[model samples]
Structure formats: C-alpha cells, structure tokens
Target: MPCPACQAPSPCPQPHVGTAWKPSPDVTVERLSPGLPRRLPLRQILCLLPLALVVVVAVQHRSVLADGFGHLATAEWPWLLAAAAATCLTWVAAAVTRQGALVERLPRRRLLATQFAAGAANHLLPTGLGASAVNLRFMAVCGVPLARSSAALALYMLAESVARVGLLVALLIAFPDALRIGVLLPDGAAGPLLLAAGAVVCVALTVLLLVRRVRTVVFSFLRTALSEARSVHARPARALALWGGAITFPALQAAGLAAVGQALGLPVPPLHMAVAYLAATVAVALVPTPGGIGSVEAALIVALVAAGGPAAVATAVVLAYRIITVWLPLLPGALTLGALVRWKVI
Candidate 1:
C-alpha cells in the first residue's frame, strides 16, 4: 500500500541518511559511526566545565597569581610581547612534529588549531594525559585506526623527549658554564641514580624477553612502531618537519623565558637564562604536577639562581614568565577547546 504522507511507498516521511538533513540548527542527532567515539551534549556542558575549572584553578593558586600580577605590573611591554610571540610559535612547532610522526598529511590549519586547544586541555589534567586524549580523539575523527594512532602518539613522544634532552646537551657543550648543572644535582647522586635506572630497564627487558606471550606482544608493538617510524622518516620532508619541530618546540620555550627574564631585569644573561629554562624543564620532567605548576616554578627559580641571578629576581622572573605563557592564554585556549568540541573536531 502507498504511504498517505508521501504517497510513494509503504514507509512515510523517511529521514535523510546523509549529512545534508538535520533536525535543527542548534541540536544534533548523532548516528553512530565507526572510529568516532564521543557525541556529548556539548552546548552548555562544554562552556560550564571550563568555567568551573578556571574558578577551581584560580582559587587554588591565588597567591601565585597575586605575585605574578604584581611583577607583571612593571614588566617591559616590548619584550613581553616577544615572549608571547614565541609562546604562540610553540603550537606551530607541535603541529609540525605531529604531522611528521605519521605518513598521511593532516589538514594544516585544523592541526595547528587543535594544538592550541590541546594546550588548555593539557593544563586541566596531569602532565601529557590531557593532550594525548585530545590528539587521540582528533586522530580517531580523522579516520585513523586506533592501533596506528597509538603508534604515532608513541613515536611523537619519543622524538620530542629525545630532541629536548639532545638540545640541552648541545647547549651545555656549547657553553660549559652556561648554568651550574652539577650544582642543580645533589653531590655524588648521579652515579647511583644512573645505575639504578639501568638496573630497572634491564630487569624489565629481561622479563619481557623471558615470557613468551609478553615477548610476542612486545615484538609486535616494536615492529609496528619501527615500521611507522621508517615510513614517516623515509620522506625527507616529514623527517625534517619531525626533528625540526621537535627541536624548535623546546628552543622557543627557552627563548620565551629568556625574553621574560630580560623584561624583569633578572641578572642572568639571555643565553644563560635560556640554559636555565632548559635545565629546569629537564630536571622536573619526572614530576607529575598538572602542567608542572609548582615544581616547574621552583626548578626555574633555582636554575636562574644557579645561572647567577639573584634569588629574589629569579623568583619574580619565573612568576612573570608563567603568567604570560600559562595563565594569560588559558581562558582563550579553553574557549577554543570548547568551540572545537561543539564542532566535533576532537
């Protein structure tokens, strides 16, 4: 029998299966699809979550905020602007590095914007977790298989860590007295620490090799990671972007801190100041603070003092730098994150 409404077939008023039809402009009806995991009611929740997080973080760190604002009052605007510019460039560097970790090319603008949004997400959770979640979701939405996306994430992290430590070593070699790195470490501790770390790695590797099932899984993952790495690095452009962006990310961060130190008249020289920033970051890499908030500040201040800046001045410089790099951009970054969620970008 013909349908009364459409006068065509048995079924009446069939819904459109394609994206061209929507029930409403503001509302979204999500039909489940492979590889896309989330579809939350985003309009209000997205806005409120960031707002609440802002309040919570603010109330918790009010004193630090007060001190930073005090130092910021007398900051040199020109150099502060330079610091801001360098901070922004870190996002571009991250986007490039991420692209370099995979064979397929990502949409440049969206990747860059996702990094920006990832920054805010990063601060809200523990070190690396928030950004990893955001990027994983972004990759999933981009049609990447879960296993390959995980491999890419691992490669990106390994490359970034290597580049950061390598840059720090290069800087130390270039300027032997740039910062008193030995003083940053407790006396006679490095040897024991190194031995302990080696032992731990050896034990873990031994267990992995001895267990048949474990060894099989480990080899499988290693093969995947190596294959992906080779494929990405096989292309010169991707390889260059990977290593170049990895190096640039840390270098720009150091430069931004140096510029802020200059603005605040920290007694340390600019290059030495940069060395301080790098050493501080490297030292605190193991500390699991949200964005390394307290730990990073303390390490930076200590590093600056080791680099010949006065204790008081180093404290002020760190405060100002954190304000510019973290707090100042936080709200806008959160808003961008919310917007991306609403648009189903991540």
Candidate 2:
C-alpha cells in the first residue's frame, strides 16, 4: 500500500499523522478500519495508594524506627533470624484460619498472598479494619456473597479470640508462678479493667435492647455467622484447621516476641517471654490505635518486666520485636498489596 503523502516507495517513510493507531494483533475486530480503540484495560493501571500509605507510615515513625534499628544492632543474630521465621509463619496460620471460616475453598496461593497484604493493611488502620476490608474485598472477588463473607469474617474473629484467650488461660494455669501473675495485673488495675469490660458489655446490651433496627441486624447477622460456624465445626477437617490455625497464629506471634527477647538478652525466660507476649496483646486488644501501637508497647514493656526482665531490656525487646514483626515486612507487604490490587486478585 502507498502512503497518502508520497505514493512512490516500496515502504512509506512517513505515515499519515491523523491515521488511527495500529491495533494489537491480540484484539479481534469485526472491521479492520479504525480498529477498536487501543485503550489500556482497567487492570493495567497500577494503583499507588498502598505504596503512598507505606511511605506515610514510614515517615511518621522515622525516629522510632531509627532507634529500633539501633537496638537490633546489638541483638544476637540467630535469635533475630528465628523471630523473622516465626513472623513469616503467622501469615500461613492466618490463611488457614481464613479458609476454615468458610465452606468454600479459596485459591490457596491467592489466599496466602491476601493474608500477607492484609498484615500490611492491618498496621495502617485501627482495630483490624484495614485487614478486614482487604479480606472482604478478596472474598467478594472470589464470588462469595457479602453476607456469607461477613459471616465468615465474624467466625474467624470469634475463633481467633477464643483460641487466644484460651491459650492464655492454659499458660497461666500451667505455670502459675512463672509469669508472677500478680505483676502482670497491678493490684489496682484489675478492678478498673474488669469494670471497664463490664461497662462495655452493658452498653452493648443496652443498645441492642433499645434499638429495634440494631437488634434485628444483630440477630440476623448472628444467625448467619452461627450457621456457618456450625457447618465448619461439623467437618472434622475444617474444624481442625480452624482451631489449629487460630491457636497457631497467636502462638507464633508470641514465639516471635520471645525470640526477639532472647536476642536482646532480656532476663526473662523464653517461656515467660511468650507468656508476657500473650498477656500484653490480650490486654491491649481493644486499644484504638492502629495496630495497637502505643498501647501494645506499654503493655508489652510492663508484662515483660513482670516476667522478670529489666524494664530497659524489656523495652528494647518490644521495640526490636515490633521492628521485625511489624516494620520490616511493611513495605514489601504494601508492594504485594499493590500488585494484588493491580492484578485484580483482591
């Protein structure tokens, strides 16, 4: 074919400026002329929100991060490596728990990846909102209805909470003197904590009773959640996976902190460190800070000290543990989140 400008050559050196762009060979068109607009697909555009958030979080904690890294410098290497390994296992445990929450089996690889991304999101928002949102969206993409997905989420939370508290209770019973249970809860603090918990329960009950719509919604959601929970429990395999993962997730978390404590040469025994980790996390679970930031640090330090570690060393251990479990993987998790979002995996 000849170019419109100069029809003389075997090949046209200058193509018409206003001509339609060449279409991709992959696209099938009914008519060749002005082939379908070669626009980018929705999935092609990479989302930047996750990366931006990672930057903001990093910048906000620059000073604390610098100091945490400084503490890590003096820590033992082998134990730190163990802590990192334990941190990795937490994601696997979470993925298993997520699968056990529903009758449908999610794609294993994608589910695990979503859990990794959810961890990063968890740190960015308060009370697990970020992680819950990510998981809900992923389930929706996987064709799970919103109601069932919500039910699964509720089931997961319930199982996780039960397992965590149960484990804590067992540890306390097994080694009553080890953690100096008295020190973990200061003399006066127990009364206030109990009162606060009771008050919250009372307030929730009051709302449910007073508001008809609220009561109806609560009952409806509970029915769905309980039905799913019962179904999961009926299957031995699913029940095992659900309880095992729920138990493992928190146990691994404690193990990670214990490893960090050992690396820092904290005086507390490894078992005691694990105990402290659980107690501190359970105590601060309701704190509103993103990932329980401030509350976690304080509760952890006190708990570790109660377990017989020096206050300064306990502080160092908490800081270094957070660096490994929370800070270190944050960016990569965010990048993975961005990739998953770009690929429409979640």
Candidate 3:
C-alpha cells in the first residue's frame, strides 16, 4: 500500500503522521583515506643523532684503527677459526633460550633467524632497544602473546647476567693473588672481592623480590622495574631453560674474545678474558648509546688494555670481536628483514 504526503509505498498515514525514515544507531561507519605511501621525514632522520655520534667516534679513532687491521693481517688462522666456532655456539645458545620460554617450541631455524635479525637491529638501533622490539614483533607475528614475549626476554637476560657474574666471581676467587697484585684490583684484592659481593647482593635481591607477598606490596614502588621483569617469572621450566642458555651464551662470547686475543698474538689468558668480558659487557649494556657503539669499543679496549695487553693489541682484538659479532651478522639481518616484509610478518 502507498500512502504518504510524498506518495512513497508504506503503511498508510492519515492527515499528519509522525513517520520518519531513520537509520539504526547500531551501524558502523568509518572514514576512508586514499592509499598513499608515506615517506620518512628529514626530521625523523635527524632523530638518529646518537648513531651519528657513534660514527664520529669511529672516524676519530680511524688512525688507531688502521693499525689494528695490519695486526689482523699478520694474525693466525686458528684463533679466527675458534672465534667463528664460538660465534656459532653463541647463536645456538640464544635459540635454546627462546625454546625454553614457550609452552610450544618454535622451529629452531626461525628462532635462529629471528635472533640474527634482532642482534643486527640492536647493533644499529639506539639504546639496544631495537633487539627487544624486533623480538616482540617477531613473536606477535607468530601469534605469541605480548606477556609471553616479555617474560622470555627477561628470563634470558637475567640468566645471562647471572652467568656472567658467576664466571667473573670464579675467576676472581681462583686467582686471588693475581687480582691482589694487579694494578686494577690492587687494593689487596679487596676491590674484586667487593665487586663480587655487590654482584651477590644484586642476585640476592632478585630472589627476595620474587616472593609473592613482597612482590605485591613492593611492586608498586618498583612498578616500572617490575613491569620490565614480569616476563622472568612467567614459567618455571622456561626460566630454567633460559638460564642454561644464558650461561652458555656469555661463555661462548668469552671464548670468542679469547680466540681473538690468541689470533692477535696477545698473551692474555682466556680465563682472564672471561672476567674482562663480563666487566666490558656490563659497562656497554649500561651505556645510553644504542648498542653501546662508542662506549662498547671504549670499554672493551680499556678492559683489554688493563688486563695486560698493549694498546695496539687491545684495539685489534676489540675490532676483530666487533667484526665477527656485529658486522658479519648485519648483511644477513638486512636480508631477513626483507624476507619478513615479503611474508608480512611485520
């Protein structure tokens, strides 16, 4: 039936009907913008000021760096070979750590690739945050929840720290006289002991804070810190696995450094290199600059020098370590990033 002032087909309306055509409130609507790829702005490029500073430092040290290359040319192949082997082991350790974190295991190949990409990003990114960000992105793409990813990163990081501390403590304890007489530790060996004590305190505090009751109350004051550490306690088995991996990872890295020392004909002992490795790593990790570029180079060189190597020898060893660990992985990581893009993983 058609009835209305405008002659529309509808129910009859006599005289004046209060009928009005209206859409339902439940409809979903959104604005649509035309597709146009966005370009990075110049200002955004300028945001990489920290990275630029690292480049400047590297350039400024170029003269000393040239000599390091000469040292590498005359170096033995055995140590280089050992460094390569240790590098492989270090990646394997990372994969093991990741596997331990989750209920289900991710493919070892994928995890290895992810770690490589993450490490590469960390080397380039400011504040070493890139690696964590990459890990999170990769996990999200794989359907892992944010909570799980957070926990995994924390667990592995904590485990690695503990392993490093343990190794250094062992070295200090085993060669008490060496530490006692060394210029760096010369305070009658008290300095190294004190440092070891401090590391123990940090470990003790970590355990105490993990208690449920204390976690509830103290967590408020430690909100940010706790939030960061939340992933460490997500799963007990996972934590154990991560710790095992962490211990192996740093030990392998120390081995690599030791190999570099040997290749360059430096008389630095592998065991002593382990202690220097821990100290240099902690210093670099604490630096505000991304991946500890300038700071890492400086810390490593300084530590190696202090550990009885000459300036030239220290420079060569540090550069070699950077090459094997940092630059060697970058090209593959770039390719990995491209593959990730093609697969729509990020």
Candidate 4:
C-alpha cells in the first residue's frame, strides 16, 4: 500500500500523517537559538535619548526658532554670509587644534566630523563638558590611553586660553577705551574674585595631594602631558596647527560676532564688537551654563551696550548671532553626533 504522506513511495518509516517529525538536538538548538530575544545596544539607546530631548526642545522653542529665521531673512546677506563662513571655519579650526594636540595623526574625515559633532554636544551639556566628553571618547576609541588623552585635552585648553588672553590684551592695547573692564566688575569685587579663584585652586591641589591614588594619577598624567607636549612641538606643522588654530578659533568667533553686528546695523565699530565678544566670553567662562547659553547672551548684550551699542539693537544682534552660530547648525550637528555614535566614532 502507498503511504498517505508520500503517495509515490511505500509506507514511510517516520510518522508524517498525525504527528510531526523532530530534528536532532543540535539542529533543533541551532534553529531555535536564533529565536531568542536579543537586547538592544546601550549606545543606541543613549544616542536616541538625546535626540528625543532635542526634538522636544525644538518643538517647545518653535516660536523662537521662527523668529531667528525671520531675523536671518532680514539680515544683510553679504555680512551674514561672511558670518556664516566664519562660523564654518571655527569647526575646521577646532579639528586642526585637536589634531595638533594628539601625537598620532587621526583620520581626517572622522576628525572633522568629530569637531562638528562636538559643537552640537557642547550646546547640550555645560560649557566645554560635551566637547570634552566626545573628544575623550574618540581618543580612547583611537587607542589613546585615558591619562594621555586627558593630558592632551588639558594642553589644548591651555593653548586656547593663552591665545584668547593674548588676543584680548592686544585688542585692549589698540583700543584702550573700547571696553571698560571696570563696568563689568563691581567695585571691590576684583580682590574677592581673585582670592576666591586662588582658594579653589588650592583646594583642588590639596585634594589631589591628600588622595594617594589621585596624586599618583595626576603625576602620571602630568608626565604624559609633558612628553606629549614635547612630541607635538617637535613637528613644526603640528606646533603651528596647535597654536595657530587656537588663536584663529577665537578670532574667527569674534569675527562672526562682528559680522553679525554689521548685518544687523548694531552701530558698534567692528573692533569694538570684537572686543565686546572677547570680554563677554572671557567674563562668563566660569559660569557653567550649557554652551554659556543664558550667561553668554546676557554678557554679550551688556558688553555691547557698554561698547556704545543701543540696548535694543545689541539685543537683536546677540539674538541673531546666537541663531547663526548655535541654532542653525544644531539639527545637522545632532544628526552628525548620532551618526558618529552609530559608527562608534565617538
């Protein structure tokens, strides 16, 4: 008699009509294993979380966003274009500075992308925190030791600070009355401020010394930093990139502000505008605001007003400048950040 399951053949050995045939254990395991639930990567979740927050913020500030766009529409196109160009150059300058800080050469495209992503990150976190975290992670992924990478970060910051101070000094020399530092600082505040800063530094050093582990780590970091600094200085191009990029970064930033002032008809001289930017930024460097958000805007308005700009126009210029430098690039920058996270570049 022919089998019901296999009609062309005789009765089959395995049951196929009322019962199912089972495979061997190995095959069964192999087939079923793939069906087990797999967890999502933590990194992907982290990357998406920030994006969600950004979206929410964008929605909440839609009106402000619209206003910014409106201002851009009415802005003097030539000067605004120049400001945008300067804004673009700031990212390149940052990438160059990062390259100069590290002894090993990083991939060019990834490095620049990192800087762009860092800019977005900077806005999300407190002043400098986002960029520092991104760069630290990037260096770690690129095979740099944590201590050395941190030291490199320190070196980069120091270079930038020195350059900024030098530029501020030069500007003051050229235009002594451009900005009145006294107006920014209240009477009898300078001494207290200096003392407070000194106290903070002393406390920090004391903590480092008191904690044996921290002291050892700090010593090691200092040693690595010195070595890395020497290595960086050995190459002329790298040295120039480090210092020149540092100098150019702030100059470009100031230029962007000046250009925006011109675009909005702020009535302040270009040099005065630059001085105001430098002074405002330096004044609020320790404010701990995200990208110096509220503090920067307030300081900038005050500085510009002090520099002889009318209050209303100064406010407009500051708003427009923030729009150009911060808000415009934010979405694209956020996207770049996510892409870098997905690719494990940061």
* Candidate topping TM-score: 4
Residue-wise C-alpha lDDT for candidate 1, range 1-346, written one tens digit per residue: 5543445675646753542522334443344344676755556697568657867887899999999999989999899999999999999999999999989888888899899888887887788887899899899989988778888999999999999999888888998898876668889999998998899999999999789999998788888889999999899999999999999999999999999988988877898998888889988888888888889999999999889999999999999999988888888888888877878887
- lDDT of each model, Cα atoms only? 0.87, 0.88, 0.69, 0.88
Q: Per-candidate TM vs. native?
A: 0.84, 0.86, 0.68, 0.86
- Superposition TM-score, candidate 3 onto the true structure: 0.68
Residue pairs in collision within model 3? 127-290, 151-231
Off by over 4 Å in 4: 1-38, 59-67
Measure candidate 1: CA RMSD: 6.9
Off by over 4 Å in 3: 1-68, 177-240
**Which 10-residue window of candidate 2 scores lowest in summed lDDT?**
1-10
Quote the positional error of residue 238 for candidate 4 in Å.
Answer: 0.9
Q: Worst ten-residue run, lDDT, model 1?
A: 19-28
Give a tens-digit lDDT track for model 4, residues 1-346. 4554455466567567575445544565547588787677898886786577568657766776776677777889999999999999999999999999988888899999999989988888899999999999999999998887998899999999999989999999999989866677779999999999999999999999899999998888889899989999999999999999999999999999999999989888999999999999988999997788778989999999889999888888888898999888888988899989989998
TM-score of 2: 0.86
- Distance (Å) between predicted and true CA of 206, model 2? 1.5
Q: Which candidate, 1 or 2, would have the higher TM-score against the true structure?
A: 2
Once fitted onto the true fold, the runs of candidate 1 whose alpha carbons sit more than 4 angstroms away are 1-47, 210-214
